[model samples]
Target: MGFADELFDLTGKVVLVTGGSKGLGREMAFGAARCGADIVIASRNHDACAEVAREIEAETGRKAMPYSVHIGRWDQLPGLVDAVYERFGRLDVLINNAGMSPLYDSLESVSEKLFDSVMNLNMKGPFRLSVLVGERMAAAGGGSIVNVSSTGSIRPNAGILPYAMAKSALNTMTEGLAKAYGPTVRVNTLMSGPFDTSAHDWEPESLAEGVRPHALQRIGTPSEIIGSVLYLISDASSYTTMATLRVDGGIP
Candidate 1:
């Protein structure tokens, strides 16, 4: 491998990414696979995960396993971890990428179920899974964990107040986990802004308007997120942990 490629190589690593069936999670899974990492792509959609897994293996020659999972349900998480460790025998990287932000008429009108659902999916699930996997990672030597946060965490919008709140907490947990499981395990947050997922039915004009305030003046593409993903999961960020890399296209 060339020097640059060698820096981000994940030849024997096994990575688990929640919400890996589509969008940013899909992109990260492909990036990790391309860098030679075995992948466990988990999401609510089994068929979608399987398709991505096939793509990963065909493009990278790395094993990609698709597992159906609803990350919000706490009861389902233990099995997810067990399945991965049992299959891969080891997990070197974890990306908590599953999230939900439901629209509500007002924060006061948000239903209890909706609020809890957002929190459970975005915060509680990641917390429990990280504790389970991170402890193992520490015992086994070392590993990396990436929490995907949203710009709404800091730039809260009324439409997604609950989701933003959960993400804000996630950002805090990212740093705290780094301290709690550091020296051997690196924990960080990817504070992502907006990205244009082609799968979305969003109109091009509306998408452009949304990116007007960003310094780059354009929404991000999925490929743009891979650099930071690769860096955090590989030796390139050896000295970096407990940090937030805002890949937000400069939301100025």
Candidate 2:
């Protein structure tokens, strides 16, 4: 391998990615495998996860496991962690990327259930999984944790209030975890801006208008997320921790 390639190499490393079935999570999972890591793709949809797993294995010649569980369900997280260790022996990287923001017409329209759902999935679940895996990672030597946050956190609008709040808390969690398990384990936030994911069904005209305010005047493609993710998880970022790296198409 070349000097630059050695820095980003993931040979023999294992990675666990929540929401790895599709969108940016899927892209990251594939990216990691291309760098030589075995992957565990966890998501609510077993079939979706399985498909992605198969594709990753076929394309990258790396081991890929598909596990299904709702990220919002706190009780289910431990089993997921156990299964990964049983399968891969060690987890070198974890990307807390599962999240949702259901549409609500008004602030008053947001119910307790809806708010709780958002919080549980976006913040609560990641915290539990991080503590569980991070402790193990520290004990086993070291690992890296990447919390997939949002530009929404820093640029909160009424439409995405609940999600923004949860991501804001996630940012704080990333910093605290870095300190808690550092000198060994690294923790950081991948703060993302608007991207064209399967989540949106935008026509060209609307898509162009949506990104007008961004400095780049364009939405990011899912593949654009790979470089930043690779940096955080690999040896390339050995001295970095508790940092929020933005790959947000210069969103302003």
Candidate 3:
């Protein structure tokens, strides 16, 4: 095979994507499947996960499993991992794509409850999942981890203090895991800008306005994010780790 053709192949790989029911998670799950990876879709919604899994299987002719778990609850992660291992035999990739963004007026206005919820899901959840999966990857000799972050983490947005803070912590966790896991496992964060996904609760008009200043002059679609995700998960990024790949359309 040509170098480029060989580099992106994911045959025989098993990938688990959190928040895989909708939005970018769904897109990434399908992308991995298209590249020849069996996928496990994990989210809090069982029906949604099943639906996405069916779609992936139909489109890619690959095995897709639906798993329901609240990633924010670290206690539930072990069982989820076990389920993946039991079903797939091994896991080769982990995509921490699950997150939440709640609107808060200001830093002071942020409630303790909101802060905890954001941190638990956005930061702590990914960290816990990585740790659990990283062990398996290390034992298997190697794997890849993709953490989903946001531009708000890099360029703080006013009503999103809690969300940004959690994502910021997630970025740091990505770096730390990359180093700690080392030559065995590669870890990276994808700092995303505005992307139109079904998971987002924002209205279309407001979401579009949010990304008008981006270099692309438009918000991204789920398809736009899939290429970057595929690159990170596939052999194309074999030597890459402890990196943050920004897919923000040049937004500062």
Candidate 4:
């Protein structure tokens, strides 16, 4: 097979994408489906997940199933894994894309509840889910994991200290996991810049204003992130692990 043919083809592989109902999650799920991987989308919204799954199936003619679970519970992850195995038989890739960043005042004003909520969802949830999936991947010989981190983790953004801290920890965990599960289960993180997603639901104007400084000079689309996701999951990145790929539109 040609280099391009062998590197990008995902035929017969199964991928599980958390938070795959909307935004970047939905886009990546569709992208994987297009690349010939059967997809299992896990999110808290069943209706939204079903809608996206139907759309992927229509567009790519690949199998897509939606499972609703709150990963932060940790307890809920096993059931979600079981559901994926039940539906897809085996998982070859995992995209820990689901995340939350609730608005908070300042670091001095940050509440314990808010801090824990952000850390639990953004950091702890992905770690727990990875453990569950990594074990299966190891037993099956090999697999790939892509954690969706944020640029805020490296470059702090005011008023969201907890979110940044959790993402920073997640980035660290990505490197740790890659080493711990090395030579079998490849793990990496994508440190993304500002993107226009559900943030519009909170601060529409600020969301629009936040994209001005990037090299792209515009907000990124969910489709833009899918390229990096595809590379990490496919054999194109066979030699890459313990790395953080930035898709941040040149945000320094």
Highest TM-score scorer? 2
Quick one: best lDDT, which candidate? 2
State model 3's lDDT. Answer: 0.91
- Candidate 4 residue spans exceeding 4 A from truth: 1-5, 201-212
- lDDT pick, better of 1 and 3: 1
C-alpha lDDT values of all predictions: 0.92, 0.96, 0.91, 0.88
Better of 1 and 3 by TM-score: 1
For model 2, how many clashes? 0
Question: Candidate 2 — which residues are off by over 4 angstroms?
Answer: none
lDDT for each residue of candidate 2 in 169-209, tens digit (9 for 90 to 100)? 99999999999999899999999998789887779998889
Q: Which ten contiguous residues of candidate 1 have the minimum total lDDT?
A: 195-204
Residue-pair clashes per candidate:
0, 0, 0, 0
Error of 4 at 33 (Å): 0.2
Cα TM-score per model: 0.96, 0.98, 0.94, 0.93
TM-score of candidate 1 on Cα atoms, chains taken together? 0.96
Which pairs clash in model 1? none
What local lDDT score does residue 206 receive in model 1, on the 0 to 100 scale?
Answer: 86
- Residue 87 accuracy (lDDT) in model 3: 96
